[model samples]
Target chain A: MSSHSLATRTEKTEPAPARTRRTRNRGWKPRLAPLSILRLLILFGFGIFCLVPLIWLLLTPTKTDAAILGDFPLSFGTFDRLAAAWQHLTAYSGGILFKWMLNSVYYSAGSLVITIVTGLLAGYAMATMRFPGRKTILTLTLLSMVMPATVTVLPLFLEINAVGLTNTAASVILPASFFPFGVYLAFVYFSTSVPKELLEAARLDGCSEFRAFISVVLPIAKPLIGLLAFFSFVANWNNYFLPYVMLSDQDAYNLPVGLGALMAGSPALHPERGGSFLPITRPEVALAGLIVVIPIALLFLIFQRYLVRGILSGSVKS
Target chain B: MTTSRRAAARSSATAWAFTAPYALLLLAFGVAPAVYAIYESFTSAKNPGSLGLDSYAMVLHDFRFWPAIGNVALFMVIWIPVMVCGTILLALLLHERVGRLSSTMRLIFFLPGAVTGSAAVLLWYFMLDPQVSPFAPALHAMGLHNSIDVFTSSHLAPIFALVAFITGVGQWIVVMFGALQGIPEELIESAKLDGAGPFGTALLIKLPLIRKYVIYMMILAFAAALQIFVEPSLFYSITQSGSAWWSLNQLGFAFAFGQGDFAQAATVSVILLVLSAAAALFLVFRTDFFKTEVES
Candidate 1:
């Protein structure tokens, strides 16, 4: 049925090539050809619109508090302010900002490792093992995706506190490790894209299920696993509420919560709190924001091909 | 009979081995806390020693509780359709016009998703603040002169909701664009040749094929919208006067940690969990969302 539809589609699209050829033969230009230029212009305009704020974030760090509000939106302030901002940011609360950045790294990266391993295993199991309650498990995971993390936060906070894990990295990393979306993505990728007959063939060759998954399925699932890791890292890194409610110690604060504290406690802005805040300044806050985003941007740049392929294939199969 | 019994025992052991870790985690973290919260919701908190169904009555009967739900409901009313329609449109545009420019455009849109919640909220705060934002003149021209201060009112929750929607569009657009690109190119070309305009073809062919994805995105958005914390919370903390506009989740957080009312907080969390779980179940079982049967 799909092939018949494909054939008809091909027949309909074939006339377009012939028409273009005929127009070229007559030395005639198609009217719609100029629309491509229009499309490019519109896309470029929108691209600039999207990128300006990010550029503003990058430029904001070089300026002083006064200069940021005074200077043109895109203008770079003196370079010295960058150093000053850095020094102030690091030293503001006795080097707590750096501690927050490290905490962010520990929590996000820690969570990413567990999520990728368990998600891959669960996904592989769902794809390869025809066990009882497979459908039930998959359905439950999907349902979990729709439950708001905020709703779980209060309960989770109480649970973690009761276990004496509050204000610890486990508070953040443990919850993030169980992401159902990653499991679902992996499940869909495995079921639709990975071939089952190949696994059966491997089984006949005396390969155990675990061995076959490691040797065959793992290699095929690399793109998806990479995609999942990048996303999980980014999500955990950017996570605000979980860490906010879980940890109260400034030393335990992740970048988002730390930045929030900095903004709230900035002496210039809120004089009532005294001048003591995170050693970070506004531009330093901007710099720190840039710092947090850099790893994910690098990941996107490095894995662009795999990421796009993973997304496209995953979507279609779903 | 002995062999069959041994095999049954072996299989059961394997099942337990395979499932034990997840089950333990789920029970310890997921199910137990949720169930406890539900129990807490029904119990009274007036006396430290006594616990019965009074907390639920107090929470449900409270004037603030209903408005908090109303604030979130209003947020969803504006947020869901705009995000769904806007993302689909952006995706269609990107898919139809493929080139260096389009790819660059795609990356540009996706960049916002890279911004951590703090930065996104901070940037939007600066943009919406009348004194600091470059867009202030334009906002004033549109009669939104006190735009930044709007966060204080319950009426302006929708505006705060709108900012959240705009900031979040980048990721959803990427998801929708991925789905759009997956539609066999031939299907689109055929529709074009049949004298279908771009909009017409998108509405009839591409949209229908991608309807499931659209629904999934909506469900995800709806779930996330209910969790609107960082934006509204930041706005409230910064302004320090919008406590009345707190969503149930925010209120719960405040009760537990901020106000030191653990029991009340647990009660609120329980209600949110039940509602979200119901929504999740509907999507999973009632809809054909996660079905992989046709693939094989």
Candidate 2:
């Protein structure tokens, strides 16, 4: 099937030499196609639109606040100033920034484990097995996706506080783990791609149901796993409101929430507040933004192939 | 018969085992809190002795309520269409230019999504500032000279929409592009064989084929847009000009934290919940969102 699709793709992308000659004889001056040019121009325009802010962000951490205001927008400042900016950022409240970074990883990794395990299992079950209340569970998952996460925050806070777990990491991890979207994605992939005969063949060989799932289903779910892990990790890592509402203690704050507090406390972001003794400034804030963004960006770059392949194969198989 | 019945029971047990952990978590976190919120929304915080719709009435009467709703409505009016249409157009364009170029551009487009939540707000705060923005010259050319001109209350919706679009439209573009890639090459080739140009093929063939995914994207985008909190709240904190309750979610937060009224907060949540869920339910049933057997 994949080869068939590949052949079709190649044919569509690259027309035959005979056909090209025939078109040339027909006076079809398709060279320098206007539409392709327009497409490239639009794509590049959108590309610049997306990258300018990121480029600005990357350069911001290197400059002093004065340079940010006085110098050219895209100009580079010295590494000396970059080092000074990092120092200022790290100096904020005696290196709380590092702690927030650690907390972000801790929370995201913990929740990712649960999201994958549960989402994969449930999705597999819903796809393959005929069980009572299966439709109900699926419906509930969709309904859960419909409601915005913000609607649940205060209530989640109330429930977590009622159980005396508000400040702990579990308060954030547990709620973040309720990823209905992952389960739905898994369900779609399994139902569409995974052949029932494979599992049945394994079961006939005296493998238990769970064993067949582990051996037969999981081996082909690499793309699904990649899709789930990257998304769950990014969602958990970048999530600010839940962690902010749940964790009141500054030490327990994740990078995003920590950044918010840093902004609020900074004299630089809030010029209305005028000057203060705190060293947190635009460069420091920009560095903090980079710190929050770099890990996820690195993850995306590293996993870009898997992520795209996952998306492609997901629908291609269907 | 007995043996087959036993086998059926055993398989059911195994399936339950596989799904049990997730179901339990969903019940504990998703359903339980939602139910609790529903109960709280009906019960008054001020007069717990009486359980009724007084909180809803109080919320309805609050002067900030309508304006907050209006603000989010305006944001939605801008955000949802731009996101859905922009995603589709960009995805179509990316699909047009296949191979290494498209892949690299797709990655470039998706890069902004990584800078999300409060970090996005901070980045945009600078990005919109006329003096220091990379678009400083453009801002000056447009006759805007300072932060005040950029951050005005009148400009809040568009600014937030632009920020959301920049940070958002990428992932959806990627998703929509994937859906487009799913289109059987034969179908597109056949359409081309019939002399359909790129525009006609995209508008007529590709668009219709990916209709389900588009609807799915639109529904999710609408729900997310309705919950616009972090951007507006962060902006309000930094600017200190827009009302603290600039959006519905913030209004809910203010009701809960600012006034110590969980009932009013839950009232706001319930309103949003119903709005989004109703919209979702309508769309889901109108389309094949739940049909496991999708026709490829």
The TM-score each candidate achieves on chain A is 0.82, 0.86
Model 1 chain B weakest lDDT span, ten residues long: B287-296
**Candidate 1: stretches off by over 4 Å:** A1-42, A192-220, A268-281, A305-318, B1-12, B47-51, B134-137, B143-159, B182-187, B293-296
How well does each candidate superpose onto the true structure, as a TM-score?
0.87, 0.91
Q: Against the native chain B, what TM-score does each candidate's chain B reach?
A: 0.87, 0.92
Candidate 1: share of reference interface contacts reproduced: 0.42
* DockQ of candidate model 1: 0.43
Question: What is the per-residue lDDT of model 1 for residues A1-318, given as tens digits with 9 covering 90 to 100?
Answer: 122233234335544544554455346436656664676676666667667777887788898877777778778887798888888777777888779889989998898888887788777677556556666666666666557656677888877888899888888888878777677677766765677788889878988666877898889887678878877887788889999988888889998898888776664333344565344545776776677777776776676654455444333343
Per-model i-RMS: 4.5, 3.7
Q: Model 1 — TM-score against the truth?
A: 0.87
lDDT tens digits by residue: candidate 2, A1-318: 442243245335533433553454347537537777888899999899889998999998888888899999888888998899888888889999889989999999999999999999999998889888787788888777556676688788778877899899999999999998788778877876798788889988999988888888999998788889987898899998899889989999999999998887788887666778877889889999999999898998898765555444333333
